[model samples]
Target: MNLAGRKVLVLGLGDTGLSMAKWLARRGASVRVADTRTGPPRLAELKRSLPSVPANSGPFRDEMFADIDLVAVSPGVPLAEPSVRRALDADIEVVGDIELFAQALPERHARIIAVTGTNGKSTVTSLAGAMARAAGVDCEVAGNIGPAVLDALMRREDAGRAAGLWVLEVSSFQLETTASLAADAATVLNVTEDHLDRYRSIDDYARAKARVFSGDGIQVLNRDDPRSLAMALPGRKTSTFGLDAPRHAEDWGLLERGGEPWLAQGANALLAVREMKLAGLHNAANALAALALCRALGLPLQPLLAALREFKGLPHRVELIGEADGVRWYDDSKGTNVGSTVAALVGLARLDSKLVLIAGGDGKGQDFSPLKEAVARSAREMVLIGRDALLIEAAVAGAGVPIRRAASMDQAVALAAQAARPGDAVLLSPACASFDMFRDYRHRGEVFRLAVERVIDAPKH
Candidate 1:
């Protein structure tokens, strides 16, 4: 963390890599940035952006790993990567952007409230940050949500109001490499099968998520989740939340006796839940998780709810693009897994009879039975796309739902738009990976957005 003239070799020139290198260099560290994807478009932008940092190409060199004080890695790069292995062999420290930011924080860089899970991290993290901001506390919000941690730190430093609080959406990948990053409070929303391709097993994935509580912080766990409920951290006092808690949570979101938003916190008066423009019951869970953090931090929830009501939402995760005739179109390109897809489905609040589902993507090693059942029950028709489209189709077909396969996302979107009737919902929630045809979930989301725009904006049918 003390990069005072230390040689820091950043083993990727991706956004986080470039930003970390620039930060270290500014702090008087001798920074060398190298990327295997040297021809990547990002490389040119990185070079132009951080022209001051020493840079190189090709695989990580032995010398680069041998004597460097620390190796800051991209979350996308697996822990078993050749460069990371070399760093391990050399006994050099390997950390993530989260660690670097945590290390660089001033004595009063705000208490960190971190949220991590396979799903719901972004929503919860953003909600917590919004809550803090709503309470009139200045915050530095970053990590998996937006801006690299270092970039947010720099922005705050330049503004002179550096940090009163930090709300971060930590990822398992980021958490796996962030041994030194700690927060004042942490939440593990829920754990489910995901990323088995990179991780050793579900337990390994859960272990990485458990690392979020390592900063000796207060742990906020989801009581409704078996994985979360099963977690044990000795130094961390665990507070649990979720709709299914025996005693309704003191810091939780609940529908009022009627159709009103309310946060129930013990025998005290119920806090009205923010009237969310963002749809879904999963978002209700997200709102509760954020409210839990606010209570943990001893802040008022009113502003947070106010902020959340206005929060349009992160791009691609159940984003509403347009309405054609009376049919509403939703783009949930971020639903790369069943849990995400389920969340997307739940957030849209679409009853099964009136929903048209667009799903399919590069299949990771997860069964589609749950999504299959959800589709069969909730969806009137299904449009499948991506590499695992057939598998999803088979699963739903087994449950007796009608399905159609598309050659591409656009085709699928067009089909759904055409097939959809007014007063129905056309939802794009691919419960699989996006690597089969697109670069990432964001790319898949963008294409879904464009396709939806085309369908909605097309001359009135």
Candidate 2:
């Protein structure tokens, strides 16, 4: 782990790349940066913080890989890139920020709780962090959910605070380059088709997520997802969470008490589903996963339950935005893949009413056929938008739900409002990327919220 006088090349200049550069430079590593973009977002900040480090932009140079001892890659930069492949061919040690953070963990004396899956990673990570803090444990949420792991490490070191616990929301992309993150507790919440553009197949994607269980840590898996359950290794300690009743004494699940669902560990009911502030059955599953992860570290159950009861789920993921004409509107712009949209749709299905779904974006090469069953059962109408609207329309064409296309978010919201009945809900859960029409998912959610507000303020006819 000693970097004194070692040469390192930082590939990409995003937040992760910048953090890698800062961390490497502080360890006295001779650092140089190369980014595919002529002007990366963090270029100015890089110049200000570490002016002495050499930075080259636009088309990666072959010479950049020469004389470099290690290549610290940002998750956004694929390993298949020519420059990265060249580095690998040259026998240069290539790693990511997470790997570096893992290698440095011993000095910090912190236990790690790693969470990864195609969906619900952020929700589970946030809730677990909240549970730990409520129980008076000093912990920091990092990785994909907050500041970069290396940035968090530096902040904790500078503050002279003990790194009590680290709750990380890791993505499959990060997992590809990470090797040494031996979390005290880890979970692959679920695995579904996502990032097909980068991976050869769904199996490839799931295998990358499986890396979270590389160490001798307790594995918390989703019983409902066969892919997640299949990750359990022989002789390794395992825990499970699902919407149905728990099959084992130590596992987590839902139970029926007085004709209402309650969160249960084994046959013992802990809290009623109605007591949780977060909406939807999917969130209940997320809450159970968080509880399992926290409890694996032996964190007390009382504070964890307190945190779950008070937690108001993350924004842009099944968040209720407004209500008009007795029709509720939700912003689930964070549903950037088919799995997330399916979860949201199935979780919000109601017997008395249906959903007017606003979906479609980049699609990311996902098979949208999985959405058909949920749409057929839960959605009254589907309003498609963004680049892959036609693809989704075709997928759900035989689902018996009427499909409409819109060129913009505002138009999509209007169409959904028109299609929704008095008791129905409008859900913006695009199972695709937002790059086609918006900067990101948060921007897309904001636009959807504003459009809903406009419709709510329009004078009644």
Clashes of each: 5, 0
Query: Model 1: per-residue lDDT, tens digit, 1-461?
Result: 56888888887777788778878877888787777775643677766767777677777677666568888888877879976886777788888888888777746557889889988888788778777887998887898887888888887777777678889888898887777667788888988878888988889899899888876777788877789878867766667776542264453535454565455555343544445766666776777777777778878766766777787777777877777688888878788788888667655644323778898887688777778656656677889987888787766667666788999888998888768877889888888888889998888888888888877677863
**Candidate 2 residue-wise lDDT, 308-371, digit = tens:** 9999999998999988788999999999999999999988884228999999999988899999
lDDT at position 260, candidate 2 = 92
Model 1 residue 375 CA deviation in Å: 1.5
List runs of model 2 lying over 4 Å from the truth: none
Q: By summed lDDT, which 10 consecutive residues of candidate 1 come out lowest?
A: 244-253
Evaluated against the true structure, the overall lDDT of model 1 is 0.77
Q: All models: lDDT?
A: 0.77, 0.93
Candidate 1 wrong stretches, greater than 4 Å: 40-42, 45-52, 245-256, 259-262, 267-274, 349-353, 457-461
